[model samples]
Target: MKTLLIVDDEPRTRQGVKKTLEAWSAGRLRIETAASGVEALEWMEENPTHLIITDVRMPELGGLQMLERMSQAPTKPVVIVISGHAEFEYAHKALQLGVVEYLLKPLDKTKLIHSVEKALELEEDRLRIGRMEKLLDPKLLEAGQVEAKYGQHVRDAIAYIEGHLQDPIGMKQVADHLHMNASYFSVLFKEQTGMTFSDYLTRKRLQRAKELLAQTRMPIWEVAEKIGYQTAKYFIKVFKDSESVSPTQYRQQVSDPEETIK
Candidate 1:
């Protein structure tokens, strides 16, 4: 399900928009509303919202200021800025901040709906690219780069596997990439590496998952998606089976190692 946020200083505008969107896209979207930028940031820290449709003028931290802080976050939500002010300066700044759309107040329901749909689509694409790009992130696999222990072919296979842990990869895919018969490649791989290809792949994915869980504030579903798990429930089961702890528990432990020990 897609998640969206609406931020406005006025309670009426915020709740009115939220109800309207809920009525329109109740099942497809999870809509949240905030009355200030501070509340929005707080919500964002704890929740993984997809799109933020915000009012430009707020009591304390304005929408642009909120977005500026959000830009420094690990994951940024797609944004559509709405304002009652018709000034070009506000629109210019909102666009400069990478807003998907900037519309004057009394937002047209039609335009707002279109902008919301567009932002949601963009967020899906953005997350896919982000996950794919993290496939070969050296930081995630820095400690696992011990290919010298294997033969050249096995080493190459290992590299390929690491770079595609987020993909639907199996021994056959690696074998095909190496231009070798799948059965023969499997035999050679285990002979040289001391571990079966499937085991090795799962180990690496779990290793990557651990790194992300420990080092980043990504949501559990995003972490699972990034490491090739197709669903959050499956990811949670696998992680618990492997580590004897749920992903969230592991993150909490690592986040405060001293407290965990105590």
Candidate 2:
């Protein structure tokens, strides 16, 4: 079951919202509450929730500040901000912070339910896409489907990218090699690959890094350079951002068969 966190300085409001959501969701969601934004952040560090419904004004670390903190986290829950008429400005800032919904005080039960359901739907979609992307075969570049749809130049580009991954390969370089305009090649690449050229290159580099981490005992810095990253620090950052774990952590989890050699 998905978890939901309700944050408010007022104990009565917190419990009332929690109880109402529990009843409306009919136990489909596991609901929790925090008396202050500081307490909510502490809880989030230990437990991740699917959604957070927070009051704007609190004694310490109000809703907006909490969101700014959460943005730095590796994983963040969807947020719904609740504010009064006087806090309209705060609610507007929350919208800019990417709150799924901005709710005015004297909360309407129907509107709350609708917002909660919509957030859940969006979360489900996000999770579904993440799972699908993980399962997608990067090796599909060599498959016949690529050539059938994008014709030979795109296929050749993929082959070139795979062959020259250690080189400084850019869209313009690839386009020049293929005898096509860079702008046209970029658009065509995205249409056929369903991702921008830069994104595709990054994914390829990441995939190679994962393989090297899992199957070799190479120094992390060497692995980074081999995959076209200029520095281990930047490579580690990109790896953690994409995989939610550092390269050392990932390597520790996956046993390397060649680890015994050398």
Evaluate all candidate structures by whole-model CA lDDT and list the values in order.
0.81, 0.82
- Distance (Å) between predicted and true CA of 81, model 1? 0.4
Using lDDT as the measure, the top candidate is: 2
- Give candidate 1 regions above 4 Å deviation: 136-262
> What does candidate 2's lDDT look like per residue over 1-262, in tens digits?
7889999998888998998998998978899999999999888777758889999889978889999987866556878998875566776788788898998889988999999999988877766554344434454454435566676788889889999888878999999999999999999898887888898888889888877876689999999999999899999999999889899987875552112111
lDDT of 2 at 252: 70
- Candidate number of the best TM-score: 2
Candidate 2 segments exceeding 4 Å error:
86-88, 137-262
The lDDT of model 1 is: 0.81
TM-score of each: 0.54, 0.56
Q: Write candidate 1's Cα lDDT for 29-111 as tens digits.
A: 88889999999989877777778999888988999999998876656778999888899998888888889888787878888
